[model samples]
Target: MTHLVMDVDTGIDDSLALLYLLGDSRAQLEAIVCTAGNVPARQVADNTLGWLALAGAGAIEVALGAEVPLSQPLQTTEDTHGPLGVGYAELPPHGRTISGRHAASVWSEAARSHPGEVTGLVTGPLTNLALAVQLDPELPQLLGRLVVMGGALNHPGNTRPTVEWNTAVDPDAAKIVFDRFAGLPAERRPILCPLDLTERIVMTSAHVERLAAASGCAAPERILPSDDRGRRSSADVELIRQLSDAIRFYMEFHRDMGQGFIAHMHDPFAAAVALDPGRAQYRPATLDVELAGRLTRGQIVADWPGPSGAGIWGRPPNADVAADTDPEAFFDALIERIAAVALDGPAR
Candidate 1:
């Protein structure tokens, strides 16, 4: 099994990513470190605990990290994830408490404990990981893998004209992380699942229907009320209902954005790639975050080697940037996983 440490902001997509990891038999989730991104740190922590409770995986360790970005003020995407960060999905109160340790400590300790056996997946801002790197400069070399869901690269940003939400929210931390991992061996460098590739794995209403059908639950449209208090249902069915309700607002947001009622499987795709890098195609590049330009700050610039085999600053490739994904294969595996999770009753 692949030992995993996930750092998240507990947004709608983040919740889905958590479920994917928790349900996957191949993953051994070491810890979940909450950070501020799509929501404040407190809400993120609460949401993380609540979601784990809903999954019946309350035993998982959770720790709170940075309350805000390294330098910039905290800016949440409540507009995208709804006020509670999970849209309309209301989970039961978390029965478990967070770990006494902070997120940075949890990350550092986990990395040191597992050595080159832990895969770190960050679906929120880079604040927590950056601090962990600061505490342990050798963290990049110790981790088996580091998969991140941020940046836009050649694609237009979702939050800004030139910046992705996660990186833009904490460019300083992002720069630190990219620079810190730059010296690692090619095989050990971070793998970036940017918006450029994530946007390609769109989850539409049809896909939701398929998941519901495969899981033996009512279709999303047929599941009226869409809230926990709506009606009585089996535990397995309720799981699907909760997921559908959580993404309702997100789907509408995509519709309003003219994306046709489809939500990008951003964070989950990062988790999937972390679990298995062969799911997507990657290109080696030297990446740097732009931090000085008013209009360009947080933009991830890639230095692709030319015919002369020379990068912009002659910097060696430090990251494997995802360029393409087989959407059919990806969605197939994703739906299968969700269905299996639903049929299994609940997370252990």
Candidate 2:
């Protein structure tokens, strides 16, 4: 079984990543440290609790992390993730309240308690982890593995012309984590899933239909465009209905952005890579985040023998950058795992 401590922004994609783990029996989610990225920090904690309630995940600890970036004002992507961060889905908060501990404390405590057994997964800005590292400098070596979903490594950016969303949210934190982890051994290096790798894990209306069907919803999940509106999913299962509504908004957003009617499943793909190291073809490189370019700030540079994920400046590679991943394999596991959550089935 894999023991995981997560730091997330609880956006639509982050919600899907959480569901993937909730359904997978092997993933023992130890705690969740919420940060402000997709939405406010407090809202992210509530969203995390709501998902736990929806999935009937045991009383996992949920803690609030950084309320803002290291040195910048907080900026949330409400347009991309909706006001509450779960797209159109309204997940009711459960009886569980936020942990009394701060996110940095929770981070240090979780890893220190578990030692080499904890896999640290950060699906949002690195602010929380960066703060945690400040509290505990040993955090990098303490974590057995780390999987991060951010950056635009040698690719076009999603937030700006040269930056990805998460890194753009807090480039300073990203820089700190990369620099701190640089000293770790290669085997213990974090897996970096930049946009160059994650953009390939796209989700379409058909994949939603398949996921609904796998969860025993017979409704045809279709998203059409015309002077006449398209038919949306009316799946009876609560989980299916919620996900359908959420993904439909995501698809619309992508379509409006001219990326077709698709949502980039970045976070869940990172979750999969965390569970299985070989799920993606990785290239080790020295990775760093740009902090001072007027046009290029927040851009992550991965130096291979020459550019950067897995090295640069005469330093050895500090990250195992995911250069490629099999989309079909990921979708297979995603559908099956999330389907199991809807069914409340035994973890596979």
Number of the top TM-score candidate: 2
RMSD of each: 2.9, 2.2
lDDT of 1 by residue, 307-335 (tens): 77768889888899999889978888778
Model 2: how far residue 9 lies from native, Å: 0.3
- In the range 137-195, model 2's lDDT, one tens digit per residue, is 99888899999999887889999997999999999999999998887777899999999
How many Å off is the CA of 267 in candidate 2? 0.3
Tell me the TM-score of each prediction against the true structure: 0.94, 0.95
Best of the candidates, lDDT: 2
| TM match of model 2 to true structure | 0.95
List ranges where model 2 is wrong by over 4 Å. Answer: 226-232, 306-312, 345-348
Once model 2 is optimally superposed onto the true structure by TM-score, how far is the C-alpha of residue 227 displaced, in angstroms? 9.3
Separate clash counts for every candidate: 0, 11
